[model samples]
Target: MNTGIINQQGLVFLNATGAPVLSRADSRQMRAHITKSNFAKRRQRISQVETKGGESNKQTTQQALHRRKRSQQKSQRAALDTNPTELPTTESPPCAPSLQLLRNFRYLVFLDIRPTVQDPVEKAWFDLITSEPVVFEASLAGGMRCWGPDKESQQNADLHLSRATNLLVDRISCEQVPSDAMIGAVMTMAFGERLADNDVAWNVHMEGLINMMQQRRHHGVSSLPPVFRSLIALDFMNHLLGFPRFYHLKVVDMLSSHGDQVLSKLAPIPADLSLLKTAVDAPETGHMGQTSHGVEEPLERVRLATRALREFNDPYVKATSRSLEIYLNLLWPLLFTIDLESVGSELKDAMSEFRIKACPYMDLTSPHYILGLLATEKDSEASAWFLDRIQGSVQVMRQRGWSDPLSVMKRGLVHEPHIHHQFTALLDDGINGLM
Candidate 1:
């Protein structure tokens, strides 16, 4: 390699547009002035190279450049393993666009791929730089150019998303034995849908993720941290809102036992999530009977779980109220399914409070099955707002992907408010499928 060209290659772009530039030597000096911890080593390396008095200037510069590159690679690897903000200052220009793409993806989803990633994990998640789903890849390329400076990119994003949605449905249908790459692709597409303002696509992508979780849980670390934090919360939210849960509560137990377990039991004395399943089953699995001696067993289990949750407190923990909120909300469905008339009076205030607290985690529209059911009984502001939202979304619901809660809301109980028989017929199918 020509020494002149290698020296020029060391110069780095100062901004996203690659307009401003700083000579590699000048940037290294500036970085040394700013950060003593890392640049100190660079300075020491420079000194050692300088002290070798017999060496020619060409050899000296080459050695110094090699030392600098090595240091940067070391620091970059460390930063990626932990906090990426601690990135090396000596980044090369060749990798700039690819690096920028990664930064955008990370900032949006917060899925940093931080767990003990092996070959399989790396191939799936990290390979996005080379091969992401067409949808997300287009959406990202579009995002980079979508600002006022580029109208074509903005239009391209729309066309890409429209085509992407169609492609995603086909992708989901075909991926029966989903690989990690497919999971990562689904995750990427979901976030892209969020960015593009495609709620219907976003919701559909979310359902695809849950399906992947069910299909692929046993392949690797099934109870991934996000699985506990995100999916369990989703199940609880839907369950509480009076929709059948799309995921099982026991997955929380499975997550608690294995995987990147980020969730902590919030109940000061948290009950086993299995207790939730046990409580529901105690009264009746398929069909619940009238409140008799049999009712006390399930009710007591509910009381203990509720009491633990109500008293829960751990300031430092994430999703502190999560376990409590999801649990309390779940009780509404089980209790109401067993006896609807009294459940309304009992869970009225708690349900209202829960939607307020848990709204940050899942889509507000998706988690309000209970709200729709309650709307059938009587109209409150919460129920009224939900009804309006659902009414407006009838078109989206009619789509093939929005089958679960949409079907329940439309052809069944919520569609005919006074119809008690539809509710009874749904007892087994709704909770099992939904949960």
Candidate 2:
């Protein structure tokens, strides 16, 4: 006999006769329904927890990304704060006009090489012209006058010129020994005056410059800077134009000794000069070569000229040197000597040969080439014809806005007390010597 408790589907019993009541299928079904309901409830609770965890994980990830972004911003700010030079300042960036003006000045004065920082003199000169407002304006004036000769540019140039002059005068009074920058400023002013065609003003600046340079020499600064090379070229032009030189003979010689070195510093010799081989191969020539009845001289003049030309890597420097060579070697003797009969024909021939060999390598736009033309012409007609060609070239240069230092230095051979006058006298009057 089974003694057990049995319940109906929705009720509980205290006691019952077991086997008949417990064996019902509906009771077991009811229990199974209750178990299925409990499992559904548990699954609902677990899903709710997982949904909350997902939301929390997304928020945490977003917060981490935001922190990282803010840290990067702080780092960037810190970098900017530390680098002072990179920070913005009150000074405005160089405008197109100033940059263009500086470019013009560079092309006119430095022959487009722009001064190298490796050279102290060039660096000093470059800094003055590009950084100092007054000196920059003064330097800019030359380019302005040369490029277009516009009235507005001229007016601006004059304004800058007056200011620069005052600055130079004030500085000279204060400093016992003028600095290189000061000398450069004065040189710039003199260049401006020259462009303005103010001989008296230019002369005043030159005199001041001479005194300053002399003081430098006395202070044991014997080596002249490369910037002085341009001054020397200008001085040579002055000599050619019959103006008395301001530089003393000793200074000229001292500087002359280092001229090649100075010029080599200005620019690099091109790695591949097509004409270099041609110049090197040109036949040995001159009176020196005429020795021993057709045996070439060990010191061939053509070779010497080629070597001299190579010494100056820049075309501008070469032109300046060429003009100086003509002035010293040929013109000086011809102008100062008492007798043409005493002047050796070999001297003229050597110079002519040098000119021929050196001509192929020169920048034809250079006014220095005109000096060569003038010195080598055998007759007045040829001189006049070349003069006409030069005038034509000058007109073209003016029309096209070209800047050549020598042409400006001599005022294109058209100004009063020009070199052409002396040249014409020598050729037309059959004058043996000016002295």
Top candidate (lDDT) = 2
Candidate 2 residue-wise lDDT, 162-277, digit = tens:
65677677766875565555665676676556555677987887777778777766876554444355445334434434332333244454455545453332222211112332
lDDT of 1 by residue, 1-435 (tens): 111101222332323322122233442332233334334555676777777857565457576688768886786567545531121222231211234434434322232323333343232233432232443443343332222123433443455455445655666688555544455455555544543445676567667766766766655535332222443443443343334233334444444555422333322123443444454456454433233454556556655544454442221121223323333433444443333323333333334433112211123234334433443343555444444444434432222133343443333234324333434444443433331
Error of model 2, residue 27, in angstroms: 99
State the C-alpha lDDT per candidate.
0.39, 0.43
Which sections of candidate 1 miss by over 4 Å?
1-228, 237-250, 258-291, 310-367, 372-379, 395-405, 408-435
TM-score of 1: 0.35
Cα misplacement distance, residue 282 of candidate 2 (Å): 38
> Where does the lowest 10-residue lDDT sum fall in candidate 2?
354-363
| Backbone clash numbers for all candidates listed | 8, 0
Error of 2 at 147 (Å): 4.0
* Ten contiguous residues with the weakest lDDT in model 1: 1-10
The true-versus-predicted C-alpha distance at residue 382 of model 1, in Å, is 1.7
* Model 2 ranges off by over 4 Å: 1-125, 214-220, 233-238, 243-367, 373-397, 400-435
